[model samples]
Target: MKMHLWSEFIAVIKKEVVPALGCTEPISVALAAAIAAQKLSGKVQKIAVCVSPNLMKNGMGVGVPGTGMVGLPIAAAVGAIAGDPTAGLEVLKRITPKDVIQAKALLNCDSVSVNVADVSYTLYAKVTVSSGIDFITVTIADSHTQVLSIEENGVSTYIAPQFCSKKPQSYDPFKDIVVKDLYDFAVNIPISYISFIEQAQTLNEALSIEGLTENYGLQVGMTFQRNIERGLLSHGLLTDVIMHTSAAADARMDGAMKTAMSNSGSGNQGITATVPVVVAAAYLGVGKDKTLRALVFSHLVAIYIKSQQHKLSALCGASTAAMGAAAAITFLLGGNYQQISHSLSSMIADIAGIICDGAKPSCALKVSSAAGAAVKAALLALDGMHASGDDGIVTNDVDQSIQNLCALVNGSMMQTDVQILDIMINK
Candidate 1:
């Protein structure tokens, strides 16, 4: 890779991978509400929030950190009362017990309302907060925390035209990123430049440990550990990988107050991409440099694949992130580029169409399942076996195979997203 392209890749990683305090959908909503509240005077008497359908679908069931509450109403109320907009996705990190009480009170007073917006963008949120007759409106679009506009008292205070409009043309920041390029960069990049990726391991591992040690979500990771201890499940690399990764998801989805190093605006995706690779590298006793390289490779692969799909989609993100883990595990196991590619193809072939109902405790089940599939896929790839091009959505070219999977999620699954949302709202 050229120096310029390498620099761009580093920049992309820094921009896309960062710490987030909760599921991003609700955090983004909270961020918008926080921004709107910042523009208001006196106590916020009412908060009305409208989000894109995808946001509504995702935020509807996920827990908000520190509140032990699920869905957007509480998230928006808490944002108005205590969120720090400048924190971006970590906007709710500062939320306190007092703030939780106030937020709940606001909800009980029926001062907070959430509705689906009539918007074209897959990622959009509009938050309006009122105090007496005065009101402020803040909108976020295109990307989480990318505030599009802010209006105060019927007067526009700030607006970015490029992001404010709904007909914005598609933008692909990772257009230059390819699977081969990712492999080469991960292997060849200077250790100093990529060492920052280790923070993902530290943060996500902490969440995993919390999940395993405490009862959170469905306790999938804890259950795995218990089963292993009781001799019901084998103790090995595969179980270790699933336990660590699913535990992280368990804590994240069940509202642990800790932050996760998110990838592509998702904590679960970050955990899925990082923990499996970390466990595999440790199990193999790889050196620090090699472990870092494998992690960088895994995370970059996930970011690259997710770039091909919408930020929020009907497809479960764990499936795509798990493919990245499979590639990393293959690399750690001494598999070459061809084997890594086969691992990715095998993963995509296995879990191409898993529906994303919502972000909730049950997400740990999918995360564990995807991690297990990734390990299976990697082992198969090492043995020179994988899904053939004739398999559904699997192409001879790994890149084309990824594109085919993305096409299914982004284009063909439109109705699936709508129907899922309908069922969720009605339920």
Candidate 2:
């Protein structure tokens, strides 16, 4: 890739690798609400939220980190009470116990209601706030940070969402990236950017430790660790890497308080892509540049998968990200471009159909399983193995393989996604 192209890739990576407080779905709700709150004058009294089914699905079940509460109502309340819209996904970063108390009070007064939109989009949020005689409304559409409208007192300040974003650009990951590029980057990027991976190591690994301490979630990763101690599996770099990485995921999905390094908005997805590659780097003793390159490859592959998942789906984002981790780990382990492609193909072939019912503590088991599969896929690829392209949704080309996986997520699985949410809410 040209230097300029590399720079552009780096820019996109920086944009997507942002810090988020709590689960991003609710935090995004708070972000929308905060924008309306900021526009309000005098004392704000009432707040109403309108969200699409997809947003409501994610916001419904996940625990908002720091607060024990579940769902969008409290998120909106926190937004109205203490959120800073300008802070974006980190809007709730400053939330305190007092703020939580006030937010719960707002919830008690029946201040929030989430209704499905008449028109469906992958992402949407509408927030209305009333302050005595003053009222403000804000709508977030399509993309985060791209608020479509803001109105107060029957007057509007027109700001186009396009103004905040550069002209629309399409990304072709394979055009600029091949297995060689991924491998070289993993072997040669700077330390500073890759150092962020440490946060994944510190926070997620700690959560894994906590998970083991308390026997949280399905105990998949922790259970694997115990089996290793029993000599069921040898103590090797691959085993250690996969175990530490997925164990943290086990803890996080099971409601550990630790925050994950969120990528494209999902915490478990972030952990899935990050921790595995970092653990590989640690065990392999790769230099900082190599580590950074691996981190970039891991993170970007996750982002690309997320673009297809589009923030909502029956297909879990962590599964997609774990596939990316499989690719990155393959490259880091001296696999060629063919091997990397094979690992990705094997992953999609194996785990492409897992459903994300909702954000719940039980997600840890699913995530650990995915991570374990990813490691296995990478190992198989290293041994000159590849999933047959003729097999179940597998494709010969890497990009086509990604497309096939995404189609299962986006096109053929909408009903499965909606039905799961219905079951959760009705039950």
Tens digit of per-residue lDDT, candidate 1, span 2-89: 5557777787888888999999999999999999898898899999999988898889888899999999999999999999988988
Worst 10 residues of 2 by lDDT: 174-183
lDDT of each: 0.91, 0.74
* lDDT, candidate 2, at 282: 76
Worst 10 residues of 1 by lDDT: 167-176
Q: Residues 142-222, candidate 2, lDDT per residue (tens digit)? A: 665568788887687765756567958766644645444554554455556456555655665566577666665567677
lDDT of 1: 0.91
Using lDDT, give the best candidate's number: 1
